[model samples]
Target: MITLKDVCFQYSADSTVKALRHIDLTIQDGECVVLTGESGCGKTTLTRCLNGLVPSFYEGELTGGLLLDEKNLLEMPQYEISRHVGTVFQDPRSQFFTVDSTDEVAFGCENLSMSTEKINQNIQKAFHNLRIEALKDCSLFALSSGERQKLAVAAIYAMDTPVLVLDEPSANLDLETMEVLRGILQELKREGKTIIVSEHRLSYLMGVADRYVYIQDGEIKQIWTPRQAEELSKAERKALGLRSFQSISLADIAKEGAPAEQGKRIEGRGLAVRLDKTEVFRGLTFNFQWGPAGKVVGITGNNGSGKTTFAKMLCGLLKPSEGALLFDGKPAAAKERLRQTYFVMQDTDYQLFTESVRHELELAERKNHRPCDMELILERMGLSQAAERHPLSLSGGQKQRVTIAAAMASGSDILVLDEPTSGLDGRNMQRLKETILALKKQGKLIFVVTHDMEFLDGIYDEVMSFAQKIR
Candidate 1:
């Protein structure tokens, strides 16, 4: 069992901002509890506390009693605590230290001085459980975000820890991969492991989670059993900024109308892209049309299916090895495409260069001489109150919103957002749809590279899918 008695924490002793406050909770052995809340509400911070990363790795000021069984967790070393708890972080890239999948999975066992034969056995079992046998020799750098996330979980699984804590494990996964994840979680539960998940996507956990805990501003606001969660209506869930409690089907969410064929077309002919001698795609031919005003186009596929590569080519960030791109009837030049296109990256941190949210949007507007109302844009993106806060200090979802606001202020005719809904809550996802629709009405062609079925269903006018092998 795990217990916290009046636990409170802050990153620095002098800093006034607190990450968690007066957190009182308990979990029985073999219970699966989910931590659900809005972005920046301390769900991640609480998970860090459970794994001994709060004060140990983060150098935070902590007060209160944290115990696992009879052992005082607050007094134990991080390495000692790792023997019982295994953590899978929100960003898989942050925890990876190996070049290949096989080595990565065996790293923890080696550190614990496990026998070579035992290490190999654990590796094989983990690979089989996650259905990633073919990825044993794959390079970690070459793997897609979703694949990397799976590998991260597999690595922790090989450790055979009694407690597992996962932070947003399904954020980067597609619909099919999400189902696979659910099966893995169910198997873990069957084995009598204590599981704690911090997630914004709640649908997949409905079947596996025994209880739900909601937090707000570093405090526990509510707790519910599975039976209670099922009783809440869709409106109530939305009002609380929580995602749906039931699974959503992509086929069910698809719009009724057939895709529009007549519009201003951006054509790609014989397109082939090669990165560092690795062919990502070849002989890809397609055309995307935007009507007189605009349209929302969704790009969907399994991870590593060249979605990001295609989006990069469209925004002129990467040049194709062989092909021709035409905007309307004219051949599109790299410089001209760069001038008219804005690409919001999947990793929002990579695209955010400004110190503050307001400054970021102001800089984008200044670049194009299209001055937008900074306050109005910030209000729309729900960053008005965080205008002066450092972009790096904001939550993952907030950073994504800031990047999108910058794109809107860029005054570009074409915008491509990569996984814009990755870390958003239900309310913010709806707000993003509204923002995209508003941009479409202003005659801007929009392309969203995403795996979010709910967001796609709500806004996309057309859907384009990529395959593993290009024909």
Candidate 2:
């Protein structure tokens, strides 16, 4: 359904450095193509070019032909080509220009001038296929990262375009939502839709993907068929930096102490936050006590249960409407807050601004003239090779990990992360868990807000549900 011939592309702002160089590729009808590469390897750039973003949204020097079925994407305006190619971006926040989930999903089709009845029908079909019917009434701002991603996918799915390009669709999903996406992809395949997914997590898509296309340095390194995929040697697997099904979790290695009983390290007292006419939560209370220092803690709750708000309150970013947050027997203030805590936001994109990963860490300026081993931390997070590259060019997973590495590098007493594992694979998840555990051993407070049960199950000392217990 899509083809690229001798494609060479470079951003107009920087004409000397090529984003995609001499790329030739083709995706046939009803095929599931998976693109694999380290961050900044031109995967996203290539996908963007397929649907006419090259010369349109992104001002870039383009030399070569891009065809969507019979129409040339290079010759058409983005609005004109969008009808034939639907795209789901890595960051849902960037993709969503609407207020609510339903509007967001229906926006694309509405632009195409579909009938209201048809739009409603497609909405129902998409909600059912994506298993997000429960989120139909939710505001886009209130959605967890995972919900936004699912909503974005459903929006594109409803378009029924001949070609669909999903760039890191699993970046913000929990396991349950990830499974929902996999099922939806399978159903689309059965219906003969052509799909191209660029992602870091491979195991989930391995069963459904027709071909695995590996891209490196703006070129296709190799393509593997399913039959030949199973025969890959250990060296080849290591070369890909992709793990086999059985491997130790990275968290286990990072942990300083084994799992132990849980109780309280800190407690929330009648926590409440109000903004204008909305009250995020009121009369909400909880307790967390420090356990053996180096164990990971997972805090979970349904959407709108005030996880991020609470985390922000804990980190002193937001003041509670009616409650007190105590750390080690003292009240937390903006000045005193920095000595005790750091928060990894749900959207890691918010924390990044430096030119490179190394600069990001250096700018953090942790005390003791000490920080986590930057090189080793980057290596464990699968970002060593991209350490010198612009953080913006990295994959969603890479960006998430860089933020994590920055947090770990901070010599603070507490680390509160909101959905740190959103874009990670099982291997990377393990590494993060291990890192948290190691911090716990050093007597640092580790607080995680997540919906990932696998990481929560064997890792967390206590599992608290915000939505259920907040009221």
Candidate 3:
């Protein structure tokens, strides 16, 4: 059993950020606890604390008691904590030290000084048990985020830790992919592994989580059973800033997307792309322009179905091996498309270069050569309070919004946001929806690559299913 007796922590003595405060809770052995709340509400921090990250890796002032199985985890060395607890970060790429998928899975066990024979056995077992043998020997770069996520899980599974803490494993996954994770978690739970998941996307955890702990401003506000969480009223959930507890669907989108093209303002002719001998999509043709549904287009696909490849083509990040792109009934070269396109990458950290949040927008505007109401953009994105804070210092969801705000500042005609709502709570999702609608009003051609059904249900004037086209 894991227990916290008035556990509290702060990043620095002078820092005003609420990392965690008076966190008191007990998680039973073999229980699957889910930590949830709005972005920056301290869900991640609590997970860090549980995994012995606070005061171990992150420089911080620690107070109160944190015990695991009646043992003092706070006093234990971070290395010792590793034997019992293994963490899968929100971005699986960050923790990965090797390129090969199989080797990455074995990386943790090797760290523990396990024998080579035992390591290989565990690796094979992990691959077989996780049903990810296809990812064996695969390069991490070649895999989709969901595939990489499974690899991350397989790594922790190989380590055989008693407690597994996953930080938003569903962030960039499609509904079908998330079900894979849910099944993995269910299997782990059956094996009596204590699990702690810090996530904003809650529907997938409907049956997986034994307890739902709601944290707000560093405090534990509510502890709910699965039934209570699942039965939460919509109005109450919205008021509490919780995402819908029910699994949302996009299966009906095919019916709505079956109509013929309305206009040919933007189009692709015989488009095909190859990334290092891997043909992603071939002979793809789409004439998606301003239709009755407006300008927002949602790209739908399962992981590894070439949705991101299409997005790269639209945003000029990847050149097509065959065919040409025409913009406004005129051929637009790659250089010209680059100028007109603004892509917010799935990993927002790659795009953030400025120190302060406000400076990030300023840098974007400088490159854009466009006049923008920087302060107003921040306000609309609900980031006014974090304007002076460093972009990297903010939460993952906040950093993503910062990038979108930068995209808005760029004044690009084509804005491509990859998995924009992956880490967002219900409130922030609504805010982004409003922002996207506002952008649509500005005549921007927005291509959103997402698996978020709720975001799709709210945002998407048209659905472009790469699942159908690529398959």
Error of 2 at 405 (Å): 3.5
Rank list by lDDT: 1, 3, 2
lDDT of 2 by residue, 1-471 (tens): 788889998887655568888888888999999877766577888888887777788888889888777677788876788888899998878878789889888999999899999999999999888877878977776665666778899999998887789998876665556667888899889999999998766656866899988777788888989667657875776566443422223343343444444643566788888755568788877666675454456676654567777788888788888877776556667556655678889787799989998887776645435656777767767777677878876667778888888887777667898988766654576677787777778877788887655555456666555644221
Superior by TM-score: candidate 2 or candidate 3 = 3
The clash count of every prediction, one per candidate, is 0, 16, 0
Cα RMSDs of all predictions? 2.0, 4.6, 2.1
- On the 0 to 100 scale, the lDDT of residue 107 in model 2 is 91
Candidate 2: clashing residue pairs, number: 16
* Model 1 Cα lDDT, one tens digit per residue, 89-200: 9888888998998999999888777899999999999999988887888888778778888899999999988999999999888777788889989999899999999988
Model 3 off-target regions past 4 Å? Answer: 252-264, 291-294, 468-471
TM-score of each: 0.95, 0.81, 0.95
TM-score ranking, high to low: 3, 1, 2
Provide the global lDDT of candidate 3 against the true structure: 0.86
Sliding window of 10 residues with minimal summed lDDT for model 2: 244-253
